[model samples]
Target: MDDTPVRVLIVDDQTLMRQGLRKLLEIEPGVTVSGAAASGQEALALLATTTVDVALVDAKMPGMDGVALIRRLAAEHPSVACVILTTFDDDEYIFGGLAAGARGFLLKDTPPDELVTTLRRAAAGETVLGSPAAERVVARLRTDPHGTGLEALSAREREVGDLIAQGAHNREIARRLFITEGTVKNHVTALLRKLGMRDRTQLALFLAKHRDQR
Candidate 1:
């Protein structure tokens, strides 16, 4: 909480959303809007030339998308923290954003003061999950505290599981593992059977919870 305002870049497809966010953050005491972009590609270009502390990105965008942008930001601009500020709170988006290295996940309905505080905290290297996002994560952790079924997984299955937890689709997982997409699907099916999980979301959350503990 020094006087140096946290520099933030807003990335949203809607012009009004970008403008409204920019206007809102501009009035905050310890925060400043560095720039705004309409797409993920534009946001990455801006980050390449601009000095930004945090990028507030929308989860759904036309091209490149929020999760893809966040993955790139985490790899290329590790110093610039990313926060997903989208209206969608679906498990797909929530875990995908977190797995892509977002420092925070917040809904658009968040109060102005709370949103500002989250941006500041994210810039300072904290992970912030608002409301249902936090609740979902907590519930996952509580469901399988010890990860009892993980011991049955083979090495390749474990690798696939970890990648799934990181939000990698089957094609991406296959490419990374040098395996066929069918093989990836088989591994995913086995993981679900062994873990007794209903779907990929549960599998992702189960692995993510264990990873966080480690």
Candidate 2:
């Protein structure tokens, strides 16, 4: 968030995996491994005493898995952003993690460069769900019987969604549309609620997938 390195906490049940992730994250510019934990309880406990900017959470672990941990930490540590890390290809994990308030979801095999990029993006307030998986998840949603369902948005809300689809961040959208950042945030939140979407990334995807109709 600042010129200093971004603080990250690795949460996994495996020591080796944690060590590997720490090493990889260290190689990235402006990111540091503040700590590591082998369980959800331990991670939550550590968060109580540490300054964690982002959390890389493992999907499968004993005593509170990644999805549950995301929900818990989101409620308890509103300042800390959670990004699920796992090898799970199941749709249930993807939908569940996003629904649980995970800002990003990365496969365990994500390349070091991409992992760093994802973390940086997440820290910047963008959801960086891993590529094809994120796309697939959103694709499944478009099949909703009510069509895109984005039509529920007001004219202003649709403008927000369209810019989001074009990859504009809140601040950028605010500047482009000549509105205050607070207004943009409000419109974005309203759009998400009206469309029944979880986050901005999903809203962006919806617009992108349906762009051809315009």
Candidate 3:
């Protein structure tokens, strides 16, 4: 808690799942699994008492599923970055998870090394969400006939979308906006979730079609 490694909380319905996460994350340097919980209620109780940098929350659990868990976490523990680990990749879950303010959405079969890396990114407060299933969702959004979801973007998000349309990378957008790259990255994530697009590519393309209106 004092000048120590990054503290993490693991939340999953299965005891074996928590144990596996503990063992895997223990190997990462400067990262500690501070606590493990069996349900969203337990996770909320633990968060109220302890400090954690990132939380690996299972997407499905009894009583409170991952979506609601993320919503409550965002409302109660706004600083905690949630990385949803789930077995399913349904678009409904992806959109629902991001809407709940999860920083990253990962699958259970993700490699141990990638899992650690994703956790590090989350601890640093960046947004990252993508999976093979999300690719189709992205494409559908890009090709949707009315594009109503993306039309609701805020002014700043619209500007970012314009630049993304012009093929600017995150660093370039940061430079242009005079903001830190981290902020730009966060904006990109927010835009994706708000617009229901899958990634930057889809976002860029969305702007390509809607620039005249902007």
Candidate 4:
């Protein structure tokens, strides 16, 4: 494993929260606080110049909320992994963050060590949800085990979905399936549309919930 520390950017509207997070992460051996921003615009500005490996964002900022920030980051800085760190555990915020491209959704009460671990995992290209967030998703999966249009997916699309459920990103999926990364992305897009899902996290959970059906 690489010993290089993950560079994290903190984006929270609260001064105390941003400062506290920076202090907490700075004490960790394998994590570094790259910068702290008070809002989404500041975060975008900082991201334009700073080399951030992961963005730890609050879900309920004043101007551009965490979900919108993640969406912008997904389009503007695709390499920077995003994680939502917020006090709100409502389904709207949790699902919104995940659907908007956050690699992780963690409650503000998450342990310091777990937050650091989540940042590392997100930077490494794995979608991670904190324990509370995971429980909510699991409940949702139990209720909606089969998504709307799984039967419409082609065989290759099903393979891609399975790979996603196995925690494989596009590059890894491409390698495993003997296809180009571009092709893997195409399949992922198709799967998302066919399943009425917003992002890879939802697609993965949907596939995992209905694995027996496949």
For TM-score, the strongest prediction is 1
Candidate 4 local lDDT, 139-164, one digit each (tens): 76776564244555689988998889
lDDT by residue (1-214, candidate 1, tens digit) is 2788899999999999999999999988888899999999999899878999999999889867787788788889999999999988866566667766889999999999999999999999999999988986776567656634464568998899889989999999999999999999989866764554557898899889886532
What TM-score, computed on C-alpha atoms, does each candidate reach? 0.70, 0.66, 0.65, 0.68
Those runs of model 1 whose alpha carbons end farther than 4 Å from true positions after fitting are: 144-214
Clash pairs detected, candidate 3: none
lDDT digits (tens) for residues 1-214 of candidate 3: 4445778999999989999899988988878998999999999999988999998999889988777788788888899999889998865456667766888888899888778878878888887765654574576477654544554456787777788889999899989988888988878876765555655786788778877766
> Which regions of candidate 3 deviate over 4 angstroms?
1-4, 133-137, 144-214
Could you tell me the lDDT of residue 188 within candidate 1?
Answer: 88
Ranking by TM-score: 1, 4, 2, 3
After aligning candidate 2 to the native by TM-score, how far in Å is the CA of 195 from where it should be? Answer: 16
Clashes of each: 0, 0, 0, 0
| True-structure lDDT of candidate 2 | 0.80
Q: For candidate 2, write residues 174-209 as lDDT tens digits.
A: 999999999999898666544446578877887888
Candidate 2 residue pairs that clash: none
| Cα error of candidate 1 at position 63, Å | 1.4
Residue 108 of model 1 has an lDDT of 96
Clashing pairs in 4: none
